[model samples]
Target: MKPAELRNLGIGAVLVALAAIFPLVNDGYWLSIATTAMMYIALSTSWSLFSGPTHLIALSTAAFFGIGGYLVGTGMSDYDTSFWSMAILAPLVATAVALLIGLATLRLSGVYFVIFTLGLAEMIRNLVSWVQNNFLGSRGLYVLTDFTEAHIYWMLLGVSVVVFLFGWWINRSRLGFALKIIGNDEEVARHVGINTAWSKVILFMSTGFFAALIGAIVAPRYSYIEPNVVFSPQLSFLVVIMALLGGTHRLWGPLVGVIPFTLAWEAISVSFPNSTTLFLGLSFLIIVYVLPDGFTGLLEKFTRRAAK
Candidate 1:
């Protein structure tokens, strides 16, 4: 590896080590906040792994995430299945769904793709709600578990670490190069012999898998799972905003955006619960207008200027 790559790896290791100490040293509100941050870190990072290179703004995160949560909820509540089994099955189910969705929708690009993905979560939520009401005669499931907040935090943190490592590997691999080419120009990528469709589908599946796994791991925290709550469209928007704010061009960029945005969002949710959506809208606008490339992009510019 180059010197810069080695330095980045060292920095990542240090940051992960520091994050691992949060649950050990804290509890209650702060630990919960850290856990939420970890969740976004994983979500946004995995999100960028696909969206960053493809430049396809997908808003189907909540769809896959809800699938995982609902699976775990149904398994534990209805089938008396173990948490581990549900968790394992969640990602597989999500991957399969992503394959179907990607095959159907990856051909579309720009705003058409964005609109379709945004609608996907709502469609899935309504479908799940209908099934529950008609067949099960229930609207929600209770996820009772012995796992504590700390356990959730650790699991989220572990997922974040894995995502970052995997992203790093992808960024250095040929697939990543192909993705960049696709993002630059699909026609050019095709001319160069890149299998654009499968490349995109593969990355999209990865995002779905991680999102679902995280959803499964965090299901017990809700205790009561409903389609609307688990499949909130807000989750999709938040992931997009967080990834964009971090500047998805670099693997570690989402972490930069997730930390501060998550903290500020927590405050906003508590202090102004009624206007959280308004604030979310405003935040997205600000990020787009002021920091289109995100904090990482700004930092890169500053670094280059300083070097000169």
Candidate 2:
């Protein structure tokens, strides 16, 4: 493996090792935080699949994410489906939604793409709210399942690791190189005969797969699914923050992003509460202007400079 790839693997190994004892080392406080952090990490990695690889800043990430949770909760409880079985169903459902979304919005570009995605997410949220109110008899439908926290926790961690590796694998593939080109210059990519339209489809669908998967597994963890929470812009912000903080369009960008960013959210929410958005926005602005490589990029640059 190249140094970057090896570094990624090494970090994954350390995280896995730490998670092995996370449940044992303390009370629910640490484990719960770790679990939450890891979920965001997984979600962030999912968004990176499209945004980093294929040059799409999809704001409709929460649509499929919430859909995942609804699939598991509604399916397992209302339809009498199994947990593991629904996990499989969740991604497929999300993929279908993503394909439809891609077809609808693929022709849109830049800020227009972002706006269309947001519109789609809002539409889904409102539609789900109606279903919850009229069809599901309100209270957002509680999912009765036997899956334990540890079961879900371990599964999330495994998936987070897998998602991280998935991003790295994309970095190494010809498709990934193609994505880089498209992201850099769609004109050049088009000149080279790259299928920009289809790539965006693949990109968005892949993102939906994981985002929906995380949303699905986590919904059961809550045992209740709400339309607003499921299709939250906060979730979108968290994913974007992870990618930006880590360094966008790179393998480890989102990986570098989740740790400090998650901790910051937890800490500030406890203290400042309402002002957290302001703080987050300021940090993001600074990062974009001053440290475009993200925190990880900065470290790598310093390491190189120090070596010289």
Tell me, by lDDT, which candidate is best. 1
lDDT of 2 by residue, 1-308 (tens): 67976886787699688886677776477777777877877888778778875556777767788888877877776777787788899999999988987887785676667778767767888887787678877464677677667667777888887887777777778777788888889989999999888877887888889988888888877877667777776677667877778876565577678888888889999999999889878877887798776877888899999999
Residue-level lDDT of model 1, residues 1-308, one tens digit each, is 99998998898889888888878898888999988888999999999999998889989899999999999999888789999999999999999999988988886666776787888989998998888888888655899999999999889989998998899888889999999999999999999999999999999999999999999999999999988889998999999999999999988889899989999899988999999989998988999899999999999999999999
- Which candidate leads in TM-score? 1
User: Considering summed lDDT, which 10 consecutive residues are worst modelled in model 1?
Assistant: 107-116
Candidate lDDT (C-alpha), each: 0.91, 0.78
Error of 2 at 238 (Å): 1.6
Tell me the lDDT of model 1 at 233: 88
Per-residue lDDT value at 222 in model 2 = 84
lDDT for position 121 in model 2: 67
Candidate 2 local Cα displacement, residue 34, angstroms: 0.3
lDDT of 2: 0.78
Off by over 4 Å in 2: 1-11, 136-140
